[model samples]
Target chain A: TQTVSQSDAHVTVFEGDSVELRCNYSYGGSIYLSWYIQHHGRGLQFLLKYYSGNPVVQGVNGFEAEFSKSDSSFHLRKASVHWSDSAVYFCAVRRNNYAQGLTFGLGTRVSVFP
Target chain B: GGIITQTPKFLIGQEGQKLTLKCQQNFNHDTMYWYRQDSGKGLRLIYYSITENDLQKGDLSEGYDASREKKSSFSLTVTSAQKNEMAVFLCASSTGLGVYEQYFGPGTRLTVL
Candidate 1:
């Protein structure tokens, strides 16, 4: 079974500061790792995904993630954060099969202060 | 661009009452899913349909029933509502061929008293 883990439950950062959210996974076979962001009282929006190729992948709103096979991790990063960047971020994993549903982590709530 | 619409933004039901949530998507995707999100917890898949008239159970499908009568719609039914149970049900869809990105709806908030 594929599972995701986000160690930090909450994080605080100042506007214009860089932020990084860590994500790790445990799966025996090939899988897809992705990140999503959910604003207050809203549904989740896709951020980025990694399957193969380069370890680094860029996402919307100046966000990017690096996939590390050796570390079994996919961490999301942003060079600079805005107050509007405050949201709950989730790390999810799914098997290679397209029909399978995603297994998600508990999520990390990021609070960006101006 | 397509949109996913979920009916009854807020729902309140009594103990042991059966409740149903509806979802409609115009993405023309072949796969749709239903998931439950509790406060401070990650989402758990309840059901998914790969195509019209197709159904699959997820890890948390014991108390839920789902239907996909048409390609554009999928519905979930709560067999029995438990008192003090509250959650948000999210509906999502994908292209079903090989795409990994799934579009989600605003979700339906359920509160059982």
Candidate 2:
């Protein structure tokens, strides 16, 4: 069994503020982790992924995540979020014994205030 | 230059009716998947195919049937539409490496009346 958990359901932050959205997973064996962003009325777009080497991975739009094997976590962070960054962010785990379908966390809705 | 296309951007079906959604990926990727997203709920994988003519059940495979007749396309059919069931069906394709990011389609919105 595999599970992905996002502790925050909704997050509000002012523009230009640093933010961190938490994600935790439970899975045995090697895993691929990814973050996706969905704007209103749009499908999810891939943000970043981590498989091996360099626990800190960089993604599009200045977003980055650090994979902590010890904590079983991969939390997405941004130095300064833009208003356009307001959207739903989902964390997912990919493991093929379950046939490699992404197991997603209930997304965190981020709101950016001017 | 790759794209994943999902048909019937929005669908309204009656309870107990069979609804089918289609997906096509131009990437020629060997793996495709279908997922269901309910309001305020996490996405649940419904079905997936590793290659042409190969189908696999996902965590939420019940109440759904899937077909992968060709490598570039996969379709999913709702066994019987549930009442008031509203969800977004997402299709995705990966490079078959078993460890890669998935590219997604825009999604088909299904509404059961």
Candidate 3:
């Protein structure tokens, strides 16, 4: 079985400041890691995914994440956040095997203050 | 280029009533999934379908039933609504499964009174 964990429940940052949301996972075989963002009263939207080769993957809205195999972590980052960036971010992971579903983290709620 | 649509954005039902949520995806994906999102808890899979007319139960399939009548449409039914039970039901689809990227619909919020 695989599991995903988002350590921070809530994060606050001022507008124009950078932010990083931490995610960790526990798995044995090959895995795929990805991120999703959800706004209030909305469904989740895909951010980015890391399968193989590249350690850092870029997502929509200038968001990027780095995959650290040694650390078993995939952390999401944004250089500059606007007020619209305030949302709940989730980290998910799944095995490469066929038909296996994704395991999502509890999610990190981000609040941007202007 | 494709989108997922879930009907009845907000649903209010009485306890012990049977409620159904519908989902339609134009993505032409081979896999469809239903998930429940509760307050403070992340999304949990309720059911999934690999192809038309196929169904697979997930971790929280106990009080729920799912059906896939066609390739593009999937429906979920709550066998019995629990009082004060409120959560969001999300519908998603993927080209295949696992590593494939899944697209989600806006979701249907269910409130049981």
Candidate 4:
């Protein structure tokens, strides 16, 4: 069984401030990690993913995440956040086997104040 | 551009009622999945299908049934609604069995009264 852990359940930041949402996964063989964002009344959207090489991956809306093998973490970051960025962000891990499907974290709700 | 459509934006079902939710995708993806999102909880996979007529159960597949009638369509049925059970059912699809990238539908909000 695989699991995903997100350190923060909620985060609040002012506009133009940089923020990072931390995510860590329990190791269990070859793993594929991805981040998704869900706006109120909307569906989940793929933000980015990391498979191999280049620890850092860029996503839409100037969002980025770095996969750290040593720390077992894939943290989402943005240099500047806007009010529109207020939403719930989820970190998901897919194990080498499909029996687990996608293990998701409880999600980090981000509130950007202007 | 392709979009995933889930029918019945909102559903009100009585306890022990059998309800079905429908999902259709124009992406022609080969994989479809159903996930349940409860308040304050992350999405949980209920069922998945790699191809037409193929069914795969996920971690939380105890009381749910799913069907893949065609390559681009998948449906999930709740065997018996539970009282005070409220969750958002999401349908997603990917190009293949790989879980790298997936597109999600708007979701169906179920309210069991």
Sort by lDDT, top down from the best: 3, 2, 1, 4
Model 3: chain A TM-score against the true structure: 0.95
| lDDT tens readout by residue for model 1, A53-74 | 8899999999999999889899
Candidate 3 residue B97 C-alpha distance from true site, Å:
1.9
- TM-score against native, each model: 0.97, 0.96, 0.97, 0.97
DockQ of 2: 0.66
Whole-model lDDT per candidate: 0.91, 0.92, 0.93, 0.91
CAPRI accuracy category, model 3: medium
| Model 1 interface DockQ | 0.65
Q: Model 2 over residues B9-110: C-alpha lDDT tens digits? A: 999999999999999999989989999988888788899899999998988899999999999999999989999999999998988755678899999999
lDDT of 4 at A102: 69
Misplaced by over 4 Å in model 2 are A96-98
Candidate 1 chain B has its poorest 10 consecutive residues by lDDT at: B94-103
- Rank order (by DockQ, best first): 3, 2, 1, 4
TM-score of chain A of each: 0.95, 0.96, 0.95, 0.94
Candidate 4 colliding pairs: none
- Tens digit per residue, CA lDDT, model 4, B1-109: 9999999899999999999999999998888899999988889889999889999998789879999989989999999999999999999998874455889999999
RMSD of each: 1.1, 1.2, 1.1, 1.2
Give candidate 3's error at residue B73 in angstroms. Answer: 0.4
Output the TM-score of candidate 2: 0.96
Error of 2 at A67 (Å): 1.2
